[model samples]
Target: MSKTVTFVILLLLVIKTSVVCRAQCSQGAIICETFGSGPRGLLPQGITNFTYRARACPDDGEYTLLDTVSGDCHGQAWHPILEDHTPNDVRGNMFVVNASYQPSEFYSQKVAGLCPGVIYEFSLWALNLNRILTAGACDEYILRNPIIAMRIEQPDGTLIKEIIQPAITRTATPIWVSLSMQFSIPTSSNDIVVKLVNKGLGGCGNDLVIDDIGFRPVHPGLSIQFSNSPDAETTVCADTRLSLTVGTATGYISPAYLWQQSQDNVTWTAIPNATLSTYAINPVRPGRTYYRLRNTQSINASAVGRAQCSAESNVLVVNGLPDSPFSLGPDQVLCEGTTQAIPAPTSLPAGTTFVWSDQSKSQNLTVSLAGTYWLETNFNGCTYRDSVIVESQNCRLDDIYVPDAFTPNNDTHNDQLVVFHAGAFLTYSFRVFDRWGNLIFVSRQIDVSWDGTFLNRPCSDGIYAWTADYSVLNPLNQTHHFVRSGRVMLVR
Candidate 1:
């Protein structure tokens, strides 16, 4: 939500320094070759001085540059995934700025058809130049200028544009200088080469090393932004994943990321596994929640300076669902005082028992009360205790029963069909018709009723007929009831 700029002397201008290091994939799981002068190379002079290091984060599995002396470039390595621009130091590579006498296509890859543009930004430490590349002032192939040229091609195998710049640092110590160039790409399938050419690597000769090579879209100016949403909230479940999108200008610089979560926002718990762009929320209370990101490194900060990271996404309230049913049965609501006899589970063919507001584990038990209750029984491979609620009845009669027969023949007393029942059935259903038999009225559950009318008008006095349906359990396992039907008379 806010912005700040920082500068780091990650690229040093140390000259003729005796530095050595070892580089490898995270966990030292894989080993690769390093650049420089001395023992390793086919050339007689040999390559040594520069080392592939597992600096500061050897244990965490990240590696970066290591200066032998107490210079500005000392620190852990960072590889910030950027958009619309290239990375800053690229971790282990030197930011050397070497100049050249002139620009030529010799070091440039030839453009085949249409070409995409590439932006290259590299910095050089002034001091460690002569030590890495095996070229110099007297070398004819090597330009007198410290600037080096490298070519990047398109996938179609054509020359893009040729990007050339002076080695990083050179004489500028502690100052972070960078070179950015956008080379038009070739219209071919293969990318332009950054290594070899017809004329001595376009002056790059033996060393113009690089590390973080980001190839992404380029966003300009103020659009460089970052966002995290819905702040924070509690969850009932144990696992959750959050999202984050960061905005950057000039692409992104040495940006480091860290996520921390906490039960009480005051003291955050650093979730080791919840990392990078998003945090995977884990087990916590089912109510309120809190989270935040610590900006270990920001895109606009100086290399040596550190700043407090922004607050994490807004609070997200999570409501977890029950993983397993409370008791071994499905949850359902029953009408209060409705004696729904429990029906032993059919799945447990061996037969099951029940427990409720009663003392018997009997196969059948009447639901004489209303409230959430649990049932315990061993079946199949596991035991289950179903937790359920029984709703209180709105009336003494949970439903209505109707018997056929009602005369609409101008009879004042027996003209309307009516429903009548006891305190047991939890639901009611009924339908009525005239002597001519046209359906005139109906009712379901406790919602609505009828007054013997057809198409919104009253029926002539006559005998009417009707049918009603209701439900009832076996009084043992509380299984669903089979349909029961009856008839009633409409009387006025």
Candidate 2:
């Protein structure tokens, strides 16, 4: 094997040895042998060579299952353990054994249904039951500690992993210590046989209790430390770009690397082309973002295959920024007779402030007169600014139409003398005069027309003079006056 492979094995063993009860396999166990709740009994005949005892206390070369071990048993050679190590249980049985006078293989089980090339953790909880003193309270003698060899092997007797557990010596207070080992199944093997061989000689104090044996897949122990900060979480200004450097990565060997990011922490997406150990982002969009490094040890470059056997580093959080950057759009024109409304964004984070050029505090800015307009958005103590130009367009400078003659004989067609203007006028007046200069018809509104009537009586059909005066806005939005006169012939 290569040196990198050797280092990986040694590092895995060293890291797993220090973990306590809390560090069970996070991925669920495939082989959970709790010796679960049942009537006090022994394992099946073919499973182990140890004889079965029906009582609470088992003698030498014997094993039994019970929920609790009484203090009166075996002349109080073992601790009175109340319950098994199974979590969240009212009554659970623990396998209690007394080593024989000679060394022997005491426990064996065939584990199957495992995926090849995947790493697995084999672990169990053990408590040394030997009392501090011998049978007599006044007599002090050396007690025999229970030492066992944990082994994993192929069904054909090929050894895969074997380690001698340190002797479980008598402590002042009996507590369960977790013993765990990590190994990967080779492609040639799909099933394994696990064995426990007692190394301690049967004696006055070689009894122990076992519970919660587990076998589950585990990810490699991949980790990283930040270069600039010691914490996993930090803050960045909204206006500045974010740059992160991984100071130290555990065993930067031949493993393939891929970086991932998450917005909600539940769903993660792989960063594109981010295969290096360092990352830099400019104009970092706001919000809380999480990043992590994933390491895969594989010869194949397939993404799905790599993800199956990948290890992820601890998540690094960058938090407390504003919303993403926004644009105010291109410059626009506002007609003289119309109003335009520009609204500030309301979905920004709390305490966000918006300031317009005119010092208006409302969420919407309404304007008629045109000029340059700008806004400053402040969030998380950072400011973003954008400006836009608003120029004026005259609405009343378009063409107007007036007919020179009309037939006001009460028919729908050509019955009224109406003036039409395409553009809006600020002020208007129209009047019709008789040949003798008498005011026959008058109107101040643009749409109102003269229907050839005066004082509710029809006027005589004749030629008459008319005049119109109106004020309209010019290109500079200034009002300009115009007067026009025309002679219209009113026919019956």
Candidate 3:
């Protein structure tokens, strides 16, 4: 053969081999069937075989091939039996299996041309047709109870897995239920059989309709990790910025991101316009909020298949300074010569530091003098302050005087003798004695006076010795006692 012809032929052979290998190594195929074909087309292509029994007449023996619509067997009009239908099957023709014909009936199909060792998911929609038949009537003859089972079998008919659905009692209104299962293809087996079986007795109400069966390969290892964010339970000041980044992703060709937030850590809502791997939050609110990133990975390079995963970042707590700490109670009045302690709020946030106006680190302040007092608190880089005025009143006995002369004759001019201006005294006493040093008058009241008489009788006019004693409160809240004595001339 010529050299050019030989080269061209070898290139063509290599190209063909490459194309075949690519097709073989590709993802598993998606097998989906809506089963909308009419009665004649019940055994559709790709399905291996099916077995069913139906009564020729209402009372006749069970035969193969029941009717398509569920309403046909019940002799009553019913809405379309299928829950959802494909665009091609808008009329929603479905496969109806009646337990009156056979106790157990099924449709089986062989899933061929699947990539070995790959994971695949299968799902189908099933409706209990018996509910519609028993609607608006109490028909005891109808047995509408049935259980659906999806079985995965080996080529030799050995059971690999059987997913038996929960028993469904017939209700007045029937609804479709979707069931799904995920399985991994065995490395040694490239093809398997899937069977949909109705496991119920041969009775009236055990009728079922099924549609929209699907099997597709899925990427099993889509995951994400969080990074470049604060640790969990971190406290930051309000209005601070928190930055987070997505670490890594697996089993995805093109991954997209969405940031979500939650207040109570339960109900989460997505943050709009946050679709990048890296996200930033500035001016966070005062309360605690939770954040997480949702990662969506496209299984194929063309973005045909998609898988989703999420990673929650550490929870960042935003804190602010507590309410002003200076509260001295309702009666802020401080008595003179007494020590008072100003109180502060005790519900401050953790890691908070307090400083008094006088630079004292204690939360409360004690003072004997009066002035304007204030406090400042710091928490999570935020500062709070409050102030109050401390008022003090002085009622001290600083001066006292006694008149040197008095007349008790009732002329209304200097008619009695008394001490003048006795200020805020805790105790006081006054006494008047005759010139012979004999006591004639005494009083404990500071304002009381002697009328120059003894026992309500006029005393002989003469010089009398008088003495006064008193005590007053000092600035230190202590009593200071004093005594003064003098001679007073009594004229009548």
Q: Give the alpha carbon lDDT tens digit for every residue of 358-394 in model 3.
A: 9999756997887888877777567667777877764
- Among residues 3 or more apart in sequence or in different chains, the pairs in candidate 2 whose N, CA or C atoms overlap within 3 Å are none
Ranking by TM-score: 2, 3, 1
**Can you write out model 1's per-residue Cα lDDT over 288-358, one digit (the tens) per residue?**
55555543224322211111112123333444432322333454456654667655444543534445445
Model 3 RMSD, rounded to 1 decimal: 25.1
When superposed on Cα atoms, how far off is each prediction in RMSD?
Answer: 16.7, 14.9, 25.1
Candidate 2 lDDT for residue 236: 73
In model 2, the runs with Cα more than 4 Å from the true position are 1-55, 58-67, 74-79, 82-93, 98-125, 128-147, 154-157, 165-193, 198-206, 212-231, 237-241, 260-275, 279-289, 299-312, 324-376, 384-492
Q: Largest lDDT belongs to which candidate?
A: 2
Better of 2 and 3 by TM-score: 2
- Candidate 2, residues 398-479, lDDT tens digits: the string is 4566797888887799999999875788888899999999998999998789998899888888899998888888778888
Q: What is the RMSD, in Å, between candidate 1 and the native fold over all Cα?
A: 16.7
Best by TM-score: 2
The reply for model 3, stretches above 4 Å from the true place, is 1-29, 36-40, 45-89, 99-102, 132-142, 221-492
Q: Which stretch of 10 consecutive residues in model 2 shows the poorest summed lDDT?
A: 1-10
